[model samples]
Structure formats: C-alpha cells, structure tokens
Target: MTKPLTDQVVLVTGGGRGLGAAIATAFAREGARVAINYLKNKGKAEALAKDLGPNALAIKCDVRATDNVASMVREVTETLGAPTTLVHNALADYSFNGDGRDDLKTLTPDHLTSQFETAAIGGLNTIKAVRPGMEEAGFGRIITIGSNLVQNPVVPYHDYTAAKSALLALTRTAAVELGPLGITVNMVSGGLLRTTDASAGTPEAVFDMIADNTPLRRVTTPAEAADSVLFFASPWGRAVTGQNLIVDGGLVFG
Candidate 1:
C-alpha cells in the first residue's frame, strides 16, 4: 500500500522495552524510520533509538491520555515525517503469573479498567492520530499486539484477556472502515513469550510446561513474535486486514 519500508515512518507505542522494543527493532531493521514511544522507560527508549541509527527517535507519551498521544504523534511527524505505519504494542503494568492473578470473584473493576485503557483506548487514540496522515497519503499499515488467551485462555487471565478481546474487536472494525482508504489493520497475537519484563514473573516451570506442550516444543521469543508484526506492516500484508494472526509456536490454534 505505502512505499517500501525504507520510505516509511513507523511509530510504536510502549516501544521502550520488552516486546515493544523488539517490535521497534524489527521495523528499524527493515529500514523504516521508527519512533519509540515510552511512558516510563525513557533511558531504554533513548538507547534503542540511538542504536537504531539516525532514522529512529524516542518520544514520551501516555497512550491512555488522548492529549499526550496527540503530542507524541505531532513530535514524530515533525521529527521523522508523518508516520505511515503504526504498531499498538503498549501494555499496562502487568504480570503473567497465573497463581497471583485475581480469580473471577476477586477481580476488581479497576483491574479491567486499567487494562482496557491501555489495550483498547490507547489503541483508539494512536489509530486516530495516524489515520489522517495515512489518509492523506492514501496508504497505511496498522498492527496491534494481542494475546492468544482470548481464543485459548488456559490460565484464566480474566482482566488481561478481556481487554485484549476488546482490542481485537477494535482492530477488526477499524479495518472495515479504513480498508477503503488503503489502510490495513490487523493483529499479531502471541502466547506466553519466553521472557519479557511483563512475563518475568512467570515461573520457570510454567515455561517448561508450555514448551513441552507446544508443537514447536519451545516457547516463542520476542523476536519471533516481532517478526510477525513486521509482516503485517509490509506490502505482503496489503490484502490482509481485520484478522488476528497468532504467533505462539502452535501452542493453541483458532
């Protein structure tokens, strides 16, 4: 749809560290000028931008706040040109430890709210910010990071899974509305990744068990999942939209 990766400006939310960082790195590797958005990990973001070369930059923004997101997009546009690609990878402070997660009765509304703010509302803000630029150019690529738990909730991550489900809904609906404008919206869902700051609390035994059960016999890594995100942003994905491609090493199938 848009020009090749070398001619694109890409913005990735929560791109300072963990899986977000991996996704940013992937875009940079493909020669895209990338904007790394971070809420708290400024140091990491700056360092990543530096390592990615002059085509990349680090910006601070809280995607949950619409105003903050608008400012960040403006900065990216000013610094790297209007972003023709976007990746909604921001995540609330969360852990994947099933034992420590709240059960159905114990989960609070606030938990759901926090997750929804980041996964859904944050996505809404970023998408809106970039849509205009994409529409002007008549081409855009949008990819959201989701979780396979929505389809196979093996650990019962109620709040996190619920929010991700809503994001999936947003991704599909946005695709339906944006497709005519030459914008493709899709999602890349991953199961328990081997290691990310968010999943560091996950027990070693859990990883081993997941690896044993997965058809690949190994937990997916951040880079592997990041690669899937890249595919959706490339010309190869021009015909695909409103779809969630699970990148969990075949742990669970749709």
Candidate 2:
C-alpha cells in the first residue's frame, strides 16, 4: 500500500517537543522520512525519533545560526535524503505567564531582537540552506508555525507576536519567489495552544477564557494545528501558497 507521502522527506525545526514533536509525528505517520531538529532537547528528540521508528532522525542545531542550520540540513540530506518539506517551528525560550512577560513599558530592543533572531532570522537561514535541494527536486513544502496572536493580540505577547508578524511577511515573500520552482511557502497560526512548552505557563483560567470565546468552545491542540501543516505539504495544497491558515477553531478569521 502506497502512502500519500511515501518517499518524501521532511525536516522540522524545534521538533523535539511540543508542537514541533506533534508535527514530526504527523509527517512520520504519513510515510515520510522525518528529521527532528532541536537546540537543547536531545533526549526528547531522540526518544521521539526512536518511537517513530527508522523513518525519523533527531539532529541538533540552533536555527538562529546560519552555519548551524546549513550543517543540519546537510546531515538531514545525507541521512534521510534531501528534505522535500521544511517546517520552521522553532521558537525562542518564552514563558506564557503574562506576569513574566515584558510589557510595552519594560520591553527592550534586546528582547524583541532575540525573538526576531529566532523566529524570522532562523527561518531565513533554514530556508536558504534547504531551498537548493528543493529546487533540484522540483517539489517543496515550507510550512511556518505562527501565532494567531499576530492578528488577535488578545494577550499582547508583544515580542512573540511581533516576531510572528515578521515571519508572515517573510512567508508571503518567499511564496511569491518559490512558487515558480514547485515550492509553496505558507503559515499555520494557532491561538494559545492547549499545552505546549511555551504555553504551559499560561493560567488555566486563561485557557478557559479563550475556549469560551472561540466558536468551537475549545483551545486548539498541537496535534490539531499540526494537521493543518500537513495540508500545505499534501497534494491538496499543491496550488496553495502564501496563505495563512488560522487553526484556532475559528477564533480569528482572516
């Protein structure tokens, strides 16, 4: 029995845990060889690769560094074949506790720069490294994990939201250029996820409030958001590019 993504190879950054892990799992389940990229979570990444069987590999690399990203892509290509799909899901260390976050008054340029370095610059590094391979293969899928907060900003996670907003601009611009080479770049943004490492610090009451406001009456899960990523990589999204799919159960419609 042939699977939809049989023979496909996918590289997911920050894939050791949380939503990255979920997205990697989804791709592996779809019969694609998966490479899980992580910065400091080796144990979790290795465990996931083991659980996902021979089709998965965990590689460590900081996406913020161009050399690191390029090296990681080389390793993935050598081990799993050149990745035809790339998911830029790596995020900087951030806690969702509103009390812990820097508000506009206290937020400094360093804080914003750190987020931009990880979310936007990191994305560029990875894309540049793997794009050549995708061009050679004449097929590619680039899915960026974003936040619905970029549009809603209900919580005003200023730095995080601002970084994602920059990512959206990059996504759209890349889509325009890559679409001609069989590469489709798109984004999947979700509201405060039920429980990701970044969102774990969020208050339970906050989650309930978001759920109450959503049409589905529930906060979206990492797995649910991950499925939307599959759509961009699947044949169904062959013609779709430069699109942002909000997967927060109808919380923010665009």
Best by TM-score: 1
lDDT of 1 by residue, 48-144 (tens): 9999999999999999999999899999999999999999999999999989999988999999999999999999999999999999999999999
Tens digit of per-residue lDDT, candidate 2, span 181-207: 889999999888879999999999989
Clashing pairs in 2: none
TM-score of each: 0.99, 0.97
Q: Please give the range of 10 consecutive residues that has the lowest summed lDDT in model 1.
A: 1-10
lDDT of each: 0.94, 0.92
Error of 2 at 228 (Å): 0.6
